[model samples]
Target: MARKPGLLMAQLLNRFIWFDAALQKSLDIRGHGGVRRLESMCMVYVHAGIRRPSELARLLGVTRQSVNTALRELEAKGLVYLEPDPEDARCKLVHFAPEGAVMREEALDIVMALEAALEENLGRKAVDDLARLVSADWGEAPVIGKKGVGKAKERKKKSA
Candidate 1:
């Protein structure tokens, strides 16, 4: 609770690294090789029955456009079907096709393999806790990062 700035930053960086590794490796297994990483993950989840584009965007910490783009690609690939919402035609309810189920099962296995890798280093309890922490707070809060803050800016200041 009373974390030092350095400690908090370290935890944030660690979460970034672990999550990136988990999601990216899973996407690569799909071999669409042209796929956007996060979007592929979104498609897999949708195939698993998570539907709403807004919810997918919330889950992935991305914009709705990003999720929609991914869905469009997945649909074009014959993996998903998006029916215009009956009550809200502006929204689409994404559902997977039979072919989509095949890919979903494959992606699920890839994710499991990545989970095993994390367990090999961090044990299962720690891994589960990390997942729980992620699910509970997936970008529901805002970041107060300073504008124009970067290593480039710091290097320029040092040179000056």
Candidate 2:
């Protein structure tokens, strides 16, 4: 199927990266240090309801170093902040600033455009069916992991 259509999953995914990179380029064609990749990626995670950098890395299938670079760029762009984790003093979490929220909203519009293009190319029903199939597979995975959403364990109760 892939060889026939020249659209293997990896190649298709590369196209998305290329598309995103171009979109980012058009957004601000300055340098590689622009407010595109990180903010764009952060918007995806935030839109998907995942804010933590740790979770973002896993969801994006990127390394922590890659995520860290993106986060730093986001910080420089005033799109995100690292707040001290109340639950764990030693840890920290990322949150969207007011401007970040605005950025996210704009990013969502861009995402919608991408989705519309995909639906148009793949056929709306096919995209919808693909979404359902992907969701079904995703539902089987637990939320927490060493590199995912982190440990979701409840606090231990005292013995009576």
Candidate 3:
């Protein structure tokens, strides 16, 4: 019999949690200070050229309020600052402070080192395959409830 889908998903989630915890520990061991995991994730997005709060929220799959709260904490830590968006006065752009730039660079270096270690432990091909699988599009989401499925079936019957 084929493996259950739920089992596979659970394994994947477990690995994600393990990796997250390991990365946090690695950061702390490197004396990078106590940067929150969410803050580091947001910084990665910022470094990748996502500057707007709304855009970060979309990329991170979180609420704008959540992103704003993280940004505020980062700002208070002197890691990020908000400025008026030149294109849109009603919006603000998140930028790294001078100290934040240094910290970002160091964090990136540490992440790269950790990835290299993971590649070594897992084998380069296996690591690459896992990356590809996660990045692949699995298709649109399925309708969850019986009521939604019934509505879909009704629409299909009407069309037919």
TM-score of each: 0.63, 0.65, 0.77
| Superposed Cα deviation of residue 22, candidate 3 (Å) | 2.6
In order, the Cα lDDT scores of the candidates are: 0.73, 0.69, 0.83
- State in Å the error of residue 157, model 3: 12
In the predicted model 3, the residue pairs found to clash are: none
lDDT of 3 by residue, 7-120 (tens): 997888788667667767876776667777677778888988999999999888899998999999999989999999999999999999887776677677767887788899
For model 2, how does the per-residue alpha-carbon lDDT over 18-92 read when each residue is reduced to its tens digit?
Answer: 768756764553333366565677666765678677788887888878887888877777777888878878766
For model 1, how does the per-residue alpha-carbon lDDT over 52-140 read when each residue is reduced to its tens digit? 88889887888999888888887788777889888787888988877766666766677678789889999999999978975794443
Candidate that scores best on TM-score: 3
Model 2: which ten-residue window has the lowest total lDDT? Answer: 151-160
Candidate 1 residue runs with Cα over 4 Å from true position: 1-32, 44-49, 58-63, 137-160
Candidate 1 local distance difference test against the native: 0.73
In candidate 2, how many clashes are counted? Answer: 0
Give the 10-residue window scoring lowest on summed lDDT in candidate 1: 140-149
At residue 22, give the lDDT of candidate 2.
59
